[model samples]
Target: MTATTPTPTPTPTSPSAPHHQPLLRPMDLAGLRLPNRVVMAPLTRARAARDGLVPTPMHADYYGRRASAGLIITEATWVSRQAIGFADVPGIYSAEQVTAWRRVTDTVHALGGRIVMQLWHTGAASHPDHLGGRVPAGPSPVNPRTRSFTTTGFQETVTPRAMTPAEIAATVADYRAAAHNARQAGFDGVEIAALGTFLIAQFLNPRLNHRTDAYGGDRTRRRRLLLEIVDAVAEPWDGRCVGVRLGPYLAAGDLFRPDAATLADHDELVTALNDHPVAYLHLRGPDRPTPDARPDTAALARYRHRFHGPLNANNGFDRETANAAIEAGTADAVSFATHFIANPDLVTRFALSRDLATGDPTTYYGGGARGYVDHPVSTWQDNPGQQP
Candidate 1:
């Protein structure tokens, strides 16, 4: 997530015109120099091995093809079985998972693309069937508004049992180990999935957390878990290798944070991270039919004063909009979620101002490489191998 003020300034479509480089060119976030500003936002593709949550060789091929972007953050990786909210999502807790992910990271690097794993825990959204018959955990028992994917079938999210103090400490440890496994998997870094409806976000949301402990109540205490996780992940790892993603305003995942509290935590977290050494802050506003979900950067005008680090703002950003954001200095870079799903060589296509392939929603998730790895880069018809 990028450091933002209340108002996010838009960048020029082409800061350096004539040559027609990408709307946002390659940039250095902390110490990571990306070839372009369009980050491959982590999308859930449940292709991991059925039993152990291990990544397969196909995962390597899948990510290696899209190495043209500034960075590729892999899909949500569950920190523990209790965190297994999504079917077939990868994991970093087991040695087998680490080994399998190593292939993915090596493949991406061999192809000249850097990758990061998005560490995640589903909290109350997790299903009992998915976690050794255990009930899901959250601030309270508030279930997700929508159905969550389970191993057996889609189930209604249940009110989860509140966790004990020891449980919270254990989760923090889970994050630490996941970070360690991420390093062992040879990843460039890890992104904290504090965004959306993950466990950490649940602990921070007052509407959901309704707890009386230090982890609940006010916005400042609510954010304690996320901040600690960030700091925990950064403890033994390089500061530049840790990134965090969250949606301050729009409710994605299972969380719908209040507008004012969203703004407050945004400032607090950024300020707290000012002294720490994290790579980037990945901020997502609402996307799709609704644009402009990013929080009021103007409210956080002081975040710039406190945190002077890399910011990657994500939403429904196109080439033109992304460049505008960069030029305005609202964000150091922009992230593309759907755009990259269809355009394998999105950077080149954007640089040349070529036509982009429309992404197939059906193939976005639950499918094999059919829609995952086979998307065309340029003219769909030009690539003989892309035909479904």
Candidate 2:
């Protein structure tokens, strides 16, 4: 007379392959040992307290549930008040925020999990309302021609004030301070958010950066700000525990179209990172398939050849394909975003070949524990033999 939930049919794996997948292999990430190659990528679920921008017990429980991942990259956290753009996003600039994050880290470590904080600055992606009635700062005074998530709702982005030389240096110092605070918060490392045409990427892309100074104009100059920020962050944690995310292929369709020039600049960016040598190069490509319906394998190969360190490849990778990439030596680790959202036991599901629960898109952001931590673990009743 006990009530029960129906179990979905188990998916089949290759007959010749072992029940254990290549994705389950233990690997090294910037000298830190990982139990598996599966990484939980940073996803922005705005559940933090709005006033102080601090994490709570809910955040601790959310991350603790997914402790089985080899590594967990936390959502983008503002390095300073100037970096905030969206409401309810977390920050690490103050002592209160750092202390709050420590609880989350302590919870994860209690379960023997590794985690890293992703430092972020939204730049032109922010609106004045979110910045205490001050225009956002960026590499150039250009509008991203996009909308941003604000307190009221989605609002159009305004033209951010171009950063002066002094302001640029201040921003780098902010990154340094954030790195120091991250260490205090007990994070395993820090990842710089340099993708999606955000603060750092704004300087990388020519379309967004139209400055006529050392921080812009050409490829080398455009990369100056990002490299400087890297140097600042490395001072606190060293290069071994640092990683940078790059999405050169990402651009505004209506405002800025990508051309051969953009591709060449991205190549230069990879080469520069190779010379500096961070923990890993987080390379992202088109989120979905192209017109040909094929993942950009050529782009992935090109990036792998350029970056000498461990390469963390992201963007819509499934269990089968991700395993294939690892087996083929194309990627050292694979980070899951959406999959991790719905299934806290994503690594187990992949290893056991169990059906994954569907994630609720409606409650993806600005919500409580409904879709954040309420997803049930797979019952796996039909395939009891496939337990990991």
Q: Best TM-score goes to which candidate?
A: 2
Cα lDDT, all candidates: 0.76, 0.85
- Residue-wise C-alpha lDDT for candidate 2, range 230-311, written one tens digit per residue: 8788888866698988876665655445568877887888888876747888877665655335455567877788888898
Candidate 2 positional error at 232, Å = 0.8
Candidate 2 — which residues are off by over 4 angstroms?
A: 1-20, 290-294, 382-388
Write down the lDDT that model 2 would get.
0.85
Off by over 4 Å in 1: 1-24, 252-257, 288-306, 379-388
